[model samples]
Target chain A: DVKVTQSSRYLVKRTGEKVFLECVQDMDHENMFWYRQDPGLGLRLIYFSYDVKMKEKGDIPEGYSVSREKKERFSLILESASTNQTSMYLCASSPSKSTEAFFGQGTRLTVV
Target chain B: DQQVKQNSPSLSVQEGRISILNCDYTNSMFDYFLWYKKYPAEGPTFLISISSIKDKNEDGRFTVFLNKSAKHLSLHIVPSQPGDSAVYFCAAIGNTGFQKLVFGTGTRLLVSP
Candidate 1:
């Protein structure tokens, strides 16, 4: 079975603090993604990496950045945490474009 | 704008009834579509999927129907159990270089026993 693991399941950070959320996939998938879930807004993509050192901005990439220095790991960074950035963050990895992606247990973030 | 849209925010059904969740997409380029189920404080899990070339795909009690002309799709769950209650999100991929999944504002389904 494929496993996508998030570094933390829950996080609390103060406003203006830099936050990092890490994810690792054991399947060595080539594509990795970061998304934030908010009520009534659904899962908005923050960023995605197709390969090591390659990144693309998604629909909601503002206030967020991502890193993919290796094949199995992807990281999401909040430039400066804000109250509005509090939400559930999810990471996913897919081996190919036409296949289903496996998701990690989300990390619930609270910014105060 | 939301490329994928789930108009119904919530739906309720009895245990033995059929639960239908609808989704529509505005992007004609999308060729692959998927449904995901998510519980509270959990990540979304892939449920079922349908390609544009096929009109219907079934896996046990869960069936996905796609209407390419209408740019619409629906998931039908028969004999829904309480365990099936969860937020259902519809996602689409256009195969534009890399797969960038566009998701709809999920529909929360509640199955009563």
Candidate 2:
């Protein structure tokens, strides 16, 4: 079975703290993505990596950065947590651009 | 601006009945469409998909119908069970490879027995 695992299910961070959200896919897929889900806003892409060390910004990449040094791992970093940034962050992977994506359980982050 | 829209926020259906969820998109460049089901505290799961070339696609009890002219799509779940209750999101992808999908706000479905 294909699985995308996120490092945390819930997280709390101070307003000025820097936070990291890790994701690993065992499917060996080439494309990995990070999206933040909010009520009434749906899911907005943050960043995605098409290959190792290749990253692309999604619609909302402000105040965030990503790393993809390894093939199966992609990490989303919050440079500075803010209260408005609180939301459910999701990680997904797909074999290719035209394929359906498999998503992780998601991490609900609360920035105080 | 929201290119994809799920006008209905929620829908209720009886068990053994068909539940229909509708979605509309403003972008004509979108060529592929997908439907995802998400439960509370979990991520969205891919349900079904249809490309612009095909008007309909089916998987077991789930069916997705596309109307290219109107930029509309619908997901029909037959004999919906209580377990089918979840939030449904419709997504559209452009021709860009490594498809970056644009999603709707999602419609919550509740199936009652």
Candidate 3:
């Protein structure tokens, strides 16, 4: 079975603070993604990395950044956390573009 | 503009009955469709998928049907169980290998005993 693990299951941050969400996959998948899920907006992609040091912006990449220094780890960075940024963040990994993806237990973030 | 749409936000069905979930897309470029089931506080899990060339695909009690002309797809679960209750998301991917999928606002399905 494939295992995708997130650094934090829940997080609390203050406005204007920097926040980081980490994800690691044991399957050594080539593609990793970061998504933020809101109540009515669904899961919108924030960023994705196809390979180490290669990143691409998704539909909703504003105020967020990503790092993929290694194949097994991907990190999401919130430049300046705000109340509106509070939501559940999910990380997923896929071995190939056309294959099924495995996801980690999401991190529920609260910005006050 | 929500290229993919799941208009029904929620649905309820009795256990042992069939649960049908619908999804529609406006983008003609989308050639691959997938369904994912998500539980509260957990990431969505891959359920079923169908390609544009095929009209239907089945796995166990779950079946997926696609209508290319109407740009619609549906997921059917036979004999729905309490454990089947969850939020279902519909996603579409273009022909590109990058696999950037456009997802629809999910529908929450509840199975009653």
Fnat per predicted structure, each in turn = 0.75, 0.73, 0.61
Question: In model 3, what lDDT does residue A49 have?
Answer: 90
lDDT of 3: 0.93
Candidate 1 residue pairs in backbone clash: none
TM-score of B chain for each model? 0.98, 0.98, 0.98
Ten residues in sequence with the least summed lDDT for candidate 2 chain A: A93-102
Each candidate's DockQ score against the native complex?
0.78, 0.75, 0.72
Model 2, residue A89: distance off in Å is 0.3
Over the stretch A1-112, how does candidate 2's per-residue lDDT look in tens digits? 8999999999999999999999999988999999999989898999998999999999999999999999999999999899999999999998874469999999999998
lDDT of 2 by residue, B46-91 (tens): 9999999999999999999999999999999997999999999999
Off by over 4 Å in 3: none
* Candidate 2 deviant stretches above 4 angstroms: none
For model 2, what is the error of residue B46's alpha carbon versus the real structure, in angstroms, after optimal superposition?
Answer: 0.9
Across the candidates, what are chain A's individual TM-scores?
Answer: 0.97, 0.97, 0.97
Residue A90 error, candidate 2, Å: 0.3
Candidate with more favorable, higher TM-score: 1 or 2: 1
